[model samples]
Target: MISLPEASLLALFLETLFYGVFFTCYWLTLGILLKKYGIQRDLLLPVATLLLCIATAHLIIDFVRALEAFVLNVDTIGADAYYSNLASPLGLAKTALYVTQPTVADSVLVWRCYVLNNRSLLVGIPGCIVLLANGAIGYYIVWCLSRTVAGTSIYTTIPGLITTFYILTMLISIVCTTHDDQDMTALISWRIWRSRRSISGGSADLLPVMIVIVEGGAIYATSVLALLLAFLTGSNGEYPAMDIGPPVVGIVFCLIILQVHFCVGNNPQPHSPSKSFTNLFGEQGEQNVGYGIEQMIEETDRSV
Candidate 1:
């Protein structure tokens, strides 16, 4: 029978394998996005290129560490020795990779937020600070672990801080995408009102893109929340979460970018004068109706 630690190692190996599969999918999707959208010339191209390199190197390190601790060393060394190996300098290097991947992913999100917000310093500066702080704390935790001979429990604040970082990122993303040239909630309300008043069956091409943005943020937020909860519980369950979370974060970001490329990049035509308002709302319907009165009434009702 497989012991708990052995099972944990097996789970880590499986998670690493799954991460490899996700990384492959990321590359394929990236290729398709670049081919179709010509995003290779965009700013995201270099960032994504760097991220891919890091992911490849990180995965290679992961497999090597797993092999050293679980397979290659298992026969010669005992279980304690196996776990102890994780505190060695090489093992510290492996643990530090978890921080590296997330930091890059967070940087991507921050850059996207900056771009989406028209490079607003108000948004970008705080994000940069938070990211830097998170990286510092993560490295400190890893450095502390590296000096120890046995694996030790990390600070609870670490996970909480990570959760905060992810929340901030999600908020920035939601604001940027939803407010990109228009408000998503307002657009959806307009659509529902228009549907109630008219019989149009056509939908906007950008609607799916917006929906994907929201869904992507939700997926990433959920994953981060799960990891935070796992850490909060102080159970070994956080191990699997740590194993799978980084790649999943990368995959989510790539998927969002790809969806945007497919939907927005393919249809680069400028909207007609009459359809400009419709494009802003990202829905297909008559644009003659005024939302000003309705918005005022809602605001007035809320105040009352």
Candidate 2:
């Protein structure tokens, strides 16, 4: 039975904490990408930067809204009244940021799936359609919110649309993560089978699986699923979940890029020129397969 203002306060606190973590991860990931691939050659650097900027903007907006509610307007409108105004300019701006952040994150996940699946139209097309639907549904929710009167409960106004949007978000995450994991697992298994003689001991046996899970956006998917469940159950917990989402998105993006960079650096291919991480996603390409196998074998040997 937490009130809207109480929920908003909790959400801001949680978001601030997570944003700090996101900032740290962002810097670390940026440094690694720049050092390994440089700014000009890698698409990931730009994507990571974009996610970071979006998350930062979202955090700033939340802080400003909170300040206006609890501090600036405390003697006049009061925190509860301020927060209950669904169509407030700050609230609308925050909603817009909320919508934009995940769309960007989901787009990147879909692109990763497409690339990892060797540019398969089957994967890319469905993902794009889902992404578009998710984006449209999100902005539609924002529009509905913008039309609500002050003190209107969001659940009353657009509960179905919010639920649908969360469901779509979860779907995109699960679908893209599944595709990435399958493609990565297939590539790793193929490499291990090809270089069976070179791999010995179980030292590196789990590394590939771990890498696949991390790179495939398992963390993001899990977070979104938790949020969806909370929202569906009519819990105030959804406040914190919704607020932390942007930072989580940024964190996942950084982790994927950083994991790939680390894996490549640790697994050197002496027989050929170093392969770009982007190239490793093309499991169907012969050159990619050759490079991937060599790197896996090298990593296995190092582990042994």
Candidate 3:
């Protein structure tokens, strides 16, 4: 008969299977986006590639950990040695995979915030600091986890950092949605909420992408919030959540990029107007009065 530890290991294997499916979907969608966008080379490619590598590394680490638990521990070493082995360096390395996954995922969100804000240093500084602090705290926790086995104190503190990261990410998304929407000239300007209604007529082409971005961020942020709650409550039931959270993070990021690619391909909206034309048009196109009204009209009709 399987014991509790064995059962938990089996459940973790199942969760790993689910994560594999999500990872596969990420690659497929990434390929489709690259093809659809006609992106020969872009920054996002490297970011996606890096994430893929990290996720693959995580999977490898998980597999090794499972082997240690099931084969080495259960089949050969006996329960006493098995439990002892769990506190070994390899065991802590396995646990470290979880930390690495979320950190990289959060960094990706931070990167998105930077890009969305027109690469403004001022805009991303806070997020960068928070991200670094998260990494530092996580590293400390991992070091402590490796060295000791008696206490829940370090583990409990992790949720706070995770919560802060998620809250900051949500704030970044909200700020970009509300303020940076105006900064993006390629797409029609519309706030995240009430987007479909606000962007009427031909301008509505960009609405779907906007919705995807907002919803994708919300999905990730909500998952983080749930994970934080699970950790804070100090329940063993948090296992399932802990197992699946990383994959959910990957899914949301991939979904956002895929949806944006699909919408942009279908929409084929115009590029941002040239700087001189923008200055002439202003917000109301009434600032300059009569200078480039005809050109602005031409650009608007052709683009929007």
Q: Best-fitting candidate, measured by TM-score?
A: 2
lDDT scores in order: 0.50, 0.64, 0.47
**Which 10 successive residues of model 3 have the least lDDT summed?**
178-187
Q: Native-vs-model 2 lDDT?
A: 0.64
Alpha-carbon RMSD to native, per candidate? 9.4, 6.9, 9.1
**Which of the two candidates, 2 or 3, achieves a greater TM-score against the reference?**
2
Model 1, global lDDT: 0.50
Q: TM-score for model 1?
A: 0.65
lDDT-better candidate, 2 vs 3: 2
Ranking by lDDT: 2, 1, 3
What tens-digit string does per-residue lDDT give for candidate 3 at 154-179?
34445566456445433433333211
TM-score of each: 0.65, 0.77, 0.64
Residue 45, model 2: Cα distance from true site in angstroms: 1.4
Error of 3 at 124 (Å): 1.3
Residue lDDT tens for model 1, 1-304: 3443664576477567757766775776557445432222243445556555665666676567667766788788755466545456655765677677666766655544453344569867876787777677677767756665544445433556555544543443344321111122233334334532332335434444345445455555555566567656665555665666556656655664444333433333333333132321123332322121123222323334
TM-score order of candidates, top first = 2, 1, 3
Q: How many pairs of residues collide in each model?
A: 0, 0, 0
Question: How high is the lDDT of residue 191 in model 1?
Answer: 38
